[model samples]
Target: MLWTITIACLLLAGLIFRQSFRKRNEEIEMAGDAGLAILEFGRAFPGEAIRAVISTANGRTVFLRLHDGKAGCMNAHGHHYSCHLIEPGMVHVTGAGPKRLNVKFSNAAFEGGMFEFRDEKEAAEVSLWLLGSFMPGLAAQNPRIVGQPG
Candidate 1:
């Protein structure tokens, strides 16, 4: 009776471990597929490829990519997502910390939403790219303002 009980316990433990491993693999696969879809549909960002992906604990994901030496960002929320060119007037930094960074979008549906990074280094890096490179370039490309006083 003792041997039978021990053997059953071992088998149950092995089964639980296998299940957990499978779940982790599924999550990884989902993330990879999500990244690929973003890349394929990101035609507005010609010649760009996903360089990094940041995921939040609350299930939001952001993709960073570069094209012709400029940076752009894309946001994915669960099964629905959108990509945008980082225009000068579109994004702004709202908060900062060693383990957190907050940015707000002006024209995006995600306006007022804060993007959380794992650490200050990552946050700073992204902020600099957005502010120093992306936004400025976006402004340079903008057409003249319409219909206001000369």
Candidate 2:
């Protein structure tokens, strides 16, 4: 009777452990997929149109450039993503390295940390988006408003 009880307890514990491990792995896998990130963000904010997506090297964060000259980010929090549309004066960014940036958010709920991009250009591009100075195709259309603050 003692042997059977011990084996049952061990089996239960193993099952619990396996479930927890699987949940964590699922979160990691979801975080790595840019399409999933974009889908989640879109679900959260259906009105926003995303122009470009920049996934970090750690696969935990995805930065988005909106079609209307806005910036946004999706951060993985456990099984769900915390999506935020970055407004003007809401964020501050500084370069940590050629391919890394230190982001600070005005909102206390949003945690800021070091974001490492895939390359220097991506890092620079995100920085420009955060700074509210990145308007690629829009700039060519309106040369008079170039360098003007929104």
Candidate 3:
């Protein structure tokens, strides 16, 4: 009876391990796809670093990160994405979300000229990071703070 109990426990542990491994693989695949989407947006290769992903209220995903100091944006939908480089004076905060942010860009490459993030703090951080990476003081001057009354 003890041997049977031990075997059952081992089986349960194996199942848990398998499930965890599968979940991790799925996440890695998603990140890889996001990196590829960022590249398709015409920036440099993401090079294995995906800083953050923000979900939009409209069911899109916005990926924000820096590649060797240059900022990149990839608005992804499934396997396809709209991407571009974030530049100072090129990005503008158009509005705020309950826990999200809305933004427009001067870059002609981004067709709709706008993107949204589900997490307000992430929105603020990404925007400031992009701005600070380029124009330095402009990010500080920007009045858009996530979770704050805009």
Best by TM-score: 2
Question: Model 1 — which ten-residue stretch has the worst lDDT?
Answer: 139-148
RMSD of each: 7.7, 4.7, 9.7
Among all candidates shown, the one with the greatest lDDT: 2
Residue 89 shift from truth in candidate 2, angstroms: 1.3
Taken over the whole model, the C-alpha lDDT of each candidate is 0.58, 0.84, 0.57
lDDT of 1 by residue, 1-150 (tens): 999999999999999999999987766655446455465447656656555555443334554635433456555544445666565567677565565557777774554456667667767767666665434444335533211244
lDDT of 3 at 111: 45
- Lowest lDDT 10-mer window, candidate 2? 132-141
How does model 1 score by TM-score? 0.55
Candidate 2 vs candidate 3: the TM-score winner is 2
Rank list by lDDT = 2, 1, 3
Better of 2 and 3 by lDDT: 2
Q: lDDT at 97 for candidate 1?
A: 56
lDDT of 2 by residue, 56-108 (tens): 98888999988766788989977689998886677878889999999999877
* CA-RMSD of model 2: 4.7
Q: CA shift at 10, candidate 2, in angstroms? A: 13
Q: lDDT, candidate 2, residue 43? A: 98
The runs of at least 3 residues in candidate 3 whose Cα sits more than 4 Å from the true structure, single-residue gaps closed, are 1-59, 67-69, 112-116, 133-150
